[model samples]
Target: MASGAIAAGLPAHELAYRELKQRILYGEFKPGRPVTLQGIADELGVGLTPIRESVRRLIAERALEFHGNRRISLPQMTHARLEEIYTVRSKLEPELACRAAAHITKADIDHLEAIDGELDRAIAFGDVGAYLKHNFRFHRALYAPANSQVLLPIVESLWLQFGPSLRVVCGRYGTSGLSDQHKEIIKALRAANIGAVREAILRDIAQGCTFITDELFANENQP
Candidate 1:
């Protein structure tokens, strides 16, 4: 069992799952890097049983890929797969943001702004980990106010799929080269313009798509 305040009451397997998922989300484990059950058990200070179960669940979630030989790794992004993800997000996410615009309170906007500030600082320092973490936080904070059970999980699943790839892009491009339309999102939200908010979300998605697509192209052209 892992000895930590957050894992105190949680079951060993659940704790392992949460920790593993977070590691993947934060790009601590790069895409296609093999992770062994024993290695994870040692790292988390838990037995292999719990770590194995946790890894199995992540595999089922498509967040981690099982490469036979008892090896597990984060999934690599492909051009086709990323295109599908962006297409879905380009539609669903903007709708979510539009809905959120109607119900957003000043406090919610304040929290989002704070998250953006953190995200900006992370970019300035070229901190890929902090940038990815805070970028997710900002979007989640924005969408949570919509209070939709169905859409939130769907959007999160998409994030789980592409997040590792985003980290790869950040590593390749450097934070200074990254682009974000989140400020446009904030401006639209503040103005209470639902159409503009939706457009901003679409633009954000488009920018991300362009970044990932460019990375994919560069990788393909490499000898």
Candidate 2:
């Protein structure tokens, strides 16, 4: 194949892997849903080899489960996994938020404010996808000042797991008025009050934890 075709086409396996991973992470493939290599290959118009490679990677990442005969399912969230992810976030995200508050520039703050406005619109329109996307960008912008490249991947992994649950929670409880926390965070950042910024972020994350925990417990009692 010519270099351009090679570049454009990409290896089928890599394409399959990326497409499958994105779907899973984005909650398009819900928890416990069966995902077969052949099914994925057919869906993506690829061959089995690439789909197999994709499945292997997801399994390694604990994002997918594989049974004896190549049967696979999206990984289900456990209380233990949630606790572990939350613990990591509790330690890292607040510190990052504090660092961001100290180092963020006016431009960064302005960008975040714009995103906050977008989030408010999403909430008003009940656009869950838009809300989630901009909400993620708002948090990412806050953490941008930290410059911790190594830590970002770990944080992003936690997000991949938590994102679906968050969607569910947002669906259950309408997201209107959620931009209040963003405003508080911006206020803390503007004042360069690292403590206030950290507290605000912690409170934001804690509220999410409370919701998820409540849902988990409620589900458990549904026998």
Candidate 3:
């Protein structure tokens, strides 16, 4: 939390790492589309050595994979992978939300409501990027009260893996009919109802995961 850690003071590789992760988490890169390390270094405005080190960290995190011919990209989706993601998400996310409900404040609820408003607008306007970004913001804010060190990172790792595929799904079928459970989560949080928080999160995960699963398998041969 030192001032030195801000912006330029951070190491080049660390800066590149954060930037690259955000790009992946927000679906700026498509799954299975490999790009060169030097290309990433140029885009990130950092040296090749630093970018390669950053990418090595991300690859260890499973956010990126080495494609053939010395390139990297977001991992492609598979049915088995989707099934594992859904199982892990369904278990962790609802628990995180419910734990959050136990300590969530009015300020937290207000923050979530604000995010949901933008999310709703994104859905209405078919703004895929905004939808992905805001939806992530809303969930992260909702769970911040929990102050979780363990479960939260696991959930985020799941999102990093899941976000690109959700992007593909949102693009194929526009933002219409995406999950509306944020409203339910907000309502429950405002009411201070822990049970309702759990329920809403479960439905939200199930609804989104189900859509992704159905869409991913609709091809029967999709990887």
Candidate 4:
């Protein structure tokens, strides 16, 4: 049990948690797909104890549902779930950006621009994984300076629930026109226009929620 051997000083159980969380967050695990503890243990080369602990945490987070026979699955999105997550995201993400506008420094803005460049490259290459990865990174970085102890975790929880389905959407539709709100967000940040930043984030949230619904729940609200 060498400390930092696996990933920058994280304990074995923590590393196991991250390995599993990344698979779910980045869309490697499809929605509603069940997986086995033994299989994950084999893949990650960790013991079942850590994997089971990680699964317990995910289950507690409501990101995974546990069943008998040593299986767990990422839940599929329901319309009610979609709208609620959207409602929270639309409201809170804007507030985060607005708060961030007050605190984001020049260096932070420069770093965000660099991440946006990577985002553009991901889109151009039609790499869904990269696009999702960088997209989340850009927003996380933008919101980091808000220094929110409470709101940030809530928002990230919302993302963990929605992120995998978004991967499914991107794969089905392709990343041809994923909205360049990051560009607008950067411009607004430069102008110091908090309102513009809020609006851009709201539009980004709406567009993303719409994509998931249109693709997965087209008949969702129909009679």
Return the top candidate by TM-score: 4
Q: Taking the candidates one at a time, how many backbone clashes does each contain?
A: 0, 1, 0, 0
TM-scores, one per candidate: 0.91, 0.80, 0.92, 0.93
- Tens-digit per-residue lDDT, 1-223, candidate 4: 3244344777777888877777788888888888899998888887889889989988877778898799988888898999999998998999999999999999999999999999899989999999999988999999999999999988887888999999998999889968758889999999999999999999889988988888889976789
What's the CA error at residue 139 for candidate 3, in Å?
0.8
- lDDT of candidate 1 at residue 204, scale 0 to 100: 89
Q: Candidates 1 and 2: which is better by lDDT?
A: 1
User: Which candidate would rank higher by TM-score, 1 or 2?
Assistant: 1
Model 1 clashing residue pairs (backbone): none
What ordering of candidates by lDDT runs from best to worst? 4, 3, 1, 2
Per-residue lDDT of candidate 1, residues 1-223 (tens digit): 4566244888889988888877787778888788888888898899888888998888877888887877888888787888899999998999899888899999999899999999999999999999999998989999998899999888887888888888888888889978888889998899998999988899888998888888766667678
| Shift of residue 107 alpha carbon in model 4, Å | 1.1
Number of the top lDDT candidate? 4
Candidate 1 Cα lDDT to native: 0.86
- Residue 197 lDDT in candidate 3: 85
Question: Which stretches of model 2 miss by more than 4 angstroms?
Answer: 1-22, 45-54, 172-180, 219-223
Q: Summarize candidate 3's per-residue lDDT along 70-99 as a digit string, tens digits.
A: 699999999899889989998999899988
Q: Poorest 10 consecutive residues of model 3 by lDDT?
A: 1-10
